[model samples]
Target chain A: MDWNCTLTEERLSDYLEGSLLPGEAAAFSAHASGCVQCTQLVAQVKMLVSRMQQAPPVEEPRHLAGRILDATLGPREREHSGSGMFAWLPSIWQPRFAMGLVTVAASILIIFHASATAGGKTALNPVNMFRAANRQVHLAYAHGAKFVNGLRVVYEIQSRLTSQPETMSEPISEPARAPNAEPRPGQPAQPPASEQRQKSQSIPHSGRRHTHGASELAALSIISREDLTNGAIRSIL
Target chain B: MRRHTRRVYNLCYRFTGNAASSEDLSQEVFLRIYRTLPSYRPEQGAFPTWLTSVTRNLLVDHYRRTRRDRLTDSIEDAMPQLEEKHSPARTPDRLAQASELSAQLQRGLARLSPELREAVILRDLQGLDYAEVQKVLQVPEGTVKSRINRGRIELARVLEEMGLRPA
Candidate 1:
């Protein structure tokens, strides 16, 4: 009666349905004949299966078939249409088309604007270019000369003090001696106090932006100083 | 129009237990079958077996989504049609007993845990081989065997309460 090691439900179901292998079928039949518990279990299982078998088939809904069919077939129809190439064109070229249009419009506007500004000028580099550049260089050198002249005055004052130390302590008490201490020949005379202040205002501040003319003049002044140093060295040689 | 729909509809009805939901679910299953027909490999299994697998899958998904207690058929509002090609001929007494037994079997089947019920349904009711049942249930053959064993024992216990033996 104890059928602990009996055939399983899957095997028994197979047995009932006549789908079991010959060996399994033979073993099951022999076992069922001898074991009361397994026999009874098989009978109950058979009845359960019979009831299920008797139950009518379930009907699927009608529209679901249509819905699924439509889903699968819709793509096929689009693929078969004559405008397939046309449909795909937008997808392929949309981004490139947008970029090309923007580039062409920008290029057209640049060319038109450049021509409008050019007006009737023969070329960008006329004789005027060289003249304007040379003028700027000249102006820078003139300003540099003024600076050197002021430094000469300061140096003269220092040398005069060393040559005559009495002038340093007697500037206020011996103001009469100042008139005789005029600048020597070929040395520029010091400007009046108000005139000197005006000249000082003309000097460029280091941090301020300079005009193109000022920059060219400053470059010329540097070249002139280098030339002077080379002349001095050659004379010594 | 009505008869054909009704027959297939009845199959869905019994399988799902709720006539209304079965109608909807069955429609969905057939639609799936219709769409997936091109992909079905005959070498894998028969069409009916494949259809049943699809139906079972759909029912399982619905059961999980609803989280309804499947072990109790307390909401049984309708019975599946009893007449079928496989229904064995019987005397009135046996027929009454069979009907009662059939209802009890349904209740017992409803009571089974989904795992055991799936194994039993796939192996017994669907008539799938062990290997085929393994594929359908997506479990090892041994696991399929154990679930079927447990499910059968539970069903036998249910039957014993009604004074029925294997007969």
Candidate 2:
């Protein structure tokens, strides 16, 4: 085979696949052997093609054909036509089934997303979740958060009233008190020290010592606006 | 028909990296085929090419419809992840390396626009000849070839970036 000195780059794939003429094959071989760049390119092309070929063939999952038949045919039509006792059911009712399927799938997705984004730990541990969340609200409030943002602010204030202490600290060795447990007579409505201490210890409150500042009051007012009005109405009644 | 299933599956798998999505898409393609079987004209083209066209059209439609929903999933799963335990291989180290390369390639394929990726997959992964790709894509042979060439070069550049491809 008298060989050419060069092979066209565009036809390299065809030449490698043996799609070229015998004479063209002889020419490609000579060029590939003599030219380092062409040789490298051929090798790379072969590797690429081989990798594609090597991709393991994955079959359609078994029962898929049956499922497809069920989808496209009526139940009686499929049943009478196919002998298999387990022939596919009619898909005429599929729109309703599909709706239910979508609902179930959406619920599962919602649940999965919630658990995944929530760090997949101890979702059943309500005490811990509540405790952790209580601390977050406290921290956010400590930073003088401007808004709770949405219709959920009422719930936020309700929850904050339950878990967080009105005052951040407590004198040690006393039992914990609830955050909004009523204040003693003639005193400002700060929670008692022991109650504060117990609640603080129960939830790991890692923020700086609470600053009893004006922004904190403003945040509290914004959060408790509805609750405060109801409380005043109750007092008058 | 059974033999063609794997090819259809691989095409779907390439478009969608996950098994769950692949299964759904493949089933969707078959259902689509069943519905549109009446419109198929034998004289117009061969069956596999027709099937490929059907598959590609469904895949493109799926991409467009679900692109928005996919963004939310990306954001939700945005945290850096470590090795997944999906491989059945006994050699953990080799399996992990293989998976990383495969993942790199999948990512590269995904980075191409749908048109380029479809052309590349049909030509390279599916091993369809240029003319057959022209049939499936309903484009000129030259256009198909150009898209394929551009797609392969870009994919190779990506693979090289990951150090999966040699100089």
Candidate 3:
């Protein structure tokens, strides 16, 4: 078959793509090899086609998909301002918030339980609740004060007992008397000379110290009783 | 949906050479697709081919609708917007070169007739084979080949005139 510049130009893509018959391709190549304009045209078109094929697709706008979705699917529910009002509601379901709410509810229940049981019988009236809460608070404060006084008395008695051992190391010319022995009925009411000497030596302020020790022991007993009652109430609850 | 959107958007941008118009056209194409989805038959073609056809038809309509504006307005005014809009986060030297070449190619494509431009875009730029291009264009395979050939030649001459040698 005869080939010319027109045939070469018309079938240029087919020739470049190697889709033309072998004879036709040879003829097209021969014609293009001799023709300067055909060669340049072939080269130019070939390069342009290759460049275009290799060119990356243009980057679309970042929000193009979102816009298309919005247009096709209608506006999203989250985009509405009305729905945004309740957005914070989801946050309330978080573990941290749930735990906090549970703790507060438990504390309120405990307070109500304590107030209701302050008296022998349960009273749900506002005035009774107030009076019960007030009484409970005073009782708690008194129990705390008594416990502290008991600790101080125990520490003072321990120190005095420890000092007594050291004093007992000294030799005694008279026999030792019981510290709490009462005077015999027929005997004189005055204390023995040995007791007087020991009192004078051991206790510089005997009267005041003895009175304070007695009051502290009484407070300690009261605290022990309160603790037992509290334990029983807890076990019942 | 995202994949289809990008394909449609790239087609519109390459055809119109205007970012805003391309964006609007892309949305319009998908909107039409969404409405006519149920009517789409599987026997017609693959989903992408159908999508391309839909996009091409909308683009042709858009072209006719805005013929008067295109005649009166300069394409150069729309060319710089593409460059300004594309500020990639990390542009290596090669990417910058490709970006410049793409812009130049866009200018060249703008000078071609709509038929030739779309033929070249679908076949060469969009990487569709001749058969797919024929399906998208709804034309004979011979006509697709002819148009692609002429379009490439014309574009090459235009790019040469603009002092760009395709490397």
lDDT of 1 by residue, A1-237 (tens): 222334544477568768777777787787787778778777777776666555533334444444444554542333322354576554434688878878998997775455444444532344544555566689889878876776665555445434543433334323332443486788668757686446435544421222433445445545654565555444434
> Better model by lDDT, 1 or 3?
3
* lDDT top scorer: 3
Q: What CAPRI class is candidate 2? A: incorrect
Model 1 residue-pair collision total = 16
Ordering by TM-score: 3, 2, 1
lDDT of 3 by residue, A70-141 (tens): 898888744332345775776666799999999999998887787787454546777889888788799989
Which tens-of-lDDT digit does each residue in B1-167 have in candidate 1? 34434434444444454545665776677677777889999998876667767777887788786665533534342222332212343224434444544445554565567788777666655556788777777778778777876777776775576445434
Model 3 regions lying over 4 Å from their true place? A78-237, B74-98
Off by over 4 Å in 1: A1-39, A46-237, B1-15, B35-45, B68-102, B162-167
Better of 1 and 3 by DockQ: 3
DockQ of 2: 0.16
The runs of at least 3 residues in candidate 2 whose Cα sits more than 4 Å from the true structure, single-residue gaps closed, are A1-42, A74-237, B70-107, B165-167
Q: For every candidate structure, what is the RMSD over all alpha carbons to the true structure, in angstroms?
A: 22.7, 32.6, 14.2
* Least well predicted 10-residue stretch by lDDT in candidate 2 chain A: A168-177
In angstroms, give how far residue B128 of model 1 lies from its true place: 3.6
